[model samples]
Target: MKKDNANASLQARKEAATPRGVGVMAPFFVARAENSELWDVEGRRFIDFAGGIAVLNTGHRHPRVVEAVRAQLDAFTHTAYQIVPYESYVALAERLNQLVPGPHPKKTTFFSTGAEAVENAVKIARYATGRGGVIAFTGAFHGRTMMGMALTGKVVPYKTGFGPFPGEVFHVPFPMPLHGVRVEDSLKALQYLFKADIDPKRVAAIIIEPVQGEGGFYVAPPELMRELRKVCDEHGILLIADEIQTGFGRTGKWFAMEHHDVAPDLMTMAKSLAGGFPLSAVTGRADVMDAPAPGGLGGTYAGSPMAIAAAHAVLDVMKEEKLVERANRLGGELRERLLALKARVPQMAEVRGLGAMLAVEFCKPGSDTPDPDFTQKVRARAMDRGLMLLTCGVYGNVIRFLFPLTIPDAHFAEALSILEASFAE
Candidate 1:
């Protein structure tokens, strides 16, 4: 591949002009990506474990997704789902209503991003209950917007200096086994909050990541989901499951809530909703979603025709390829491998996750010292070896694995070998 010197020069010029608020403005630029592989402008190949931050569940440039977008583009690209009705939008919504967990009749709406989905879920909950407060969890990463940042639990980085956030958003503990916060203890914490702070009756919803994503790969205990249902039943608060990162077969199930045998009153989903295209959704019980007045839930590009078409193809790919089952198989293999590595390296503090969304945390052997330095070292070393990886958790001592469900077995093994070598170093 010939280097586009003109394009590269323009990119370099723009890099200096771009603001820092965009987050991931990586120094390198991708010339192309197919399946689970990415080639940079300079023609360096990388096995993409990041998957556009788990947005390419179907893999990069999947033929089905690409074909769908092309077909839709040939027809009409956008008119806005609200201003002009689109069959694909309605079809995707129907599919979501049917696929999202719960036996009850449900309704669905589309949004542009996960943050928008979350914001609308809260709005719908409050509208239905006629209440003001909502609850989230610590170490949770919702989004960057004010409302999202307010509901988010962390202080530094996300919530720092961006004070005076939206009120009525409370946070409770998410019981993490590695942290010794048990399910019962988390429930007690919620109880204490209800008694000391706003009454549960005034709370509109309790939103939780079925598996805490940015907070580390701590899977929420099944008992905790049951408890959340019980509390919601008692107070009539909606249970909003944020499945942004966990949905779309990243978890073994279509939705992570399936592991708990419970259903959210509302659910927010995005990331891999439309291959790599920007799309998100808010699906839930029909009545609650209907609570908000007409014209209450929508965006300029809420359900873009192109994204909806790609989403239809994505759903097709996930089902036809049986990616959910693949996620289960991949997660088991990953966990087994990580545990085996633990036996080899004592720094492997824990190996935990559901489906393909796995993580390996590191700490100083027997002590409680979170070895974030070690985690960063491993990440940098792995990146050097052409295997891209990411680190998360409050202490940044956890490395989350988000390989594409469609990654080839050969590439997967190669990435693992690189990871092992990095850990060894």
Candidate 2:
């Protein structure tokens, strides 16, 4: 084969010129991706464990999603819902209202990203309650926008030097079994916040990720959720479930909060909502969502026709293929396999998660010290063997599994074998 021209290696050249802020995950260039795998421009195949950061629950380029996007492409790309409303956007909303938890009449508004969905949820909640303060958790990652940075709790890369965020955003401890943040401790933190930080009544909403996706895959304990629900009801504050990373059957249930049997007044969903397309939504009680007056919420690209079409297709595929059920089956096996591996690798520490949204937390043996270096080594080794995985958690010592539920069993088994061998090496 002859050497290719620089024009043919645009991605590599572009990386050299771009600022480091434009962070890249895997170094390989994607010539194409399908189901649970990626093919690099050099034609190397990789088992995809990142799943586009949990935004490809149905997998990359699912046939149905592709056909839907292609069809929409022929019809038209954008007309701007605000300029002229489209049926698909409304149709998608109707589906979310029915799919999301709760018996209350629900309404939904679409945005282009998870951050936008979360930010708008806060806006709707504040407008509804006429309050300025809101609360989040210590390990939470709401987004990178100014208000999102304010809501996000981690300080290092996400918050460091990016302070002077929007005011009145409070933080409390998020519960994790491995860390022993019990329900009582989380509840008391809320109580203490009322006493020391801000009045509960002054707060409009308490936003949280049902499963802290970026904060290390800690499933919020059911008891903690029930307590949060009670306190929110008592204080007349809305419970805003941030399902940006856990919705669309990433968790065993349709929504992670479904496991708790409590209802949130407001919900923000994105990520897999559009099967890798840019689409997100804030869905909740009709009256609460209506708090934002006309013209209060919307963006130029909100609910683009292509994304709405893909979203509708994503919902259809989830039900048609029973991906929610698939998540439970796969997640159970993943957890069990991890437990079996734990008997061997002391670095594994603890394995926990719900549905397909699972993680293995690494800590120093017989100690609580976070083992970020071990986690980093595992990821580096995994990458060398053609497995693309991601590490998360405030401590940066967790390896999360976000493979598409639609991945073939053979591929999944192969990936697991690769992981086991990586550990052995």
Candidate 1 achieves a global lDDT of 0.89
Q: Across residues 302-344, which tens digit of lDDT does each residue of candidate 2 receive?
A: 9989999999999999999999999999999888888888878
Residues 122-166 of candidate 1 have per-residue lDDT tens digits of 889989999999999988988888999998877767888887999
Scanning candidate 1 in windows of ten residues, the lowest lDDT window is 1-10
Position 409, candidate 2: lDDT: 97
Candidate 2 weakest lDDT stretch, 10 residues: 1-10
Give the best candidate by lDDT. Answer: 2
Runs with alpha carbons beyond 4 Å of true place in candidate 1? 1-15
Error of 1 at 383 (Å): 0.6
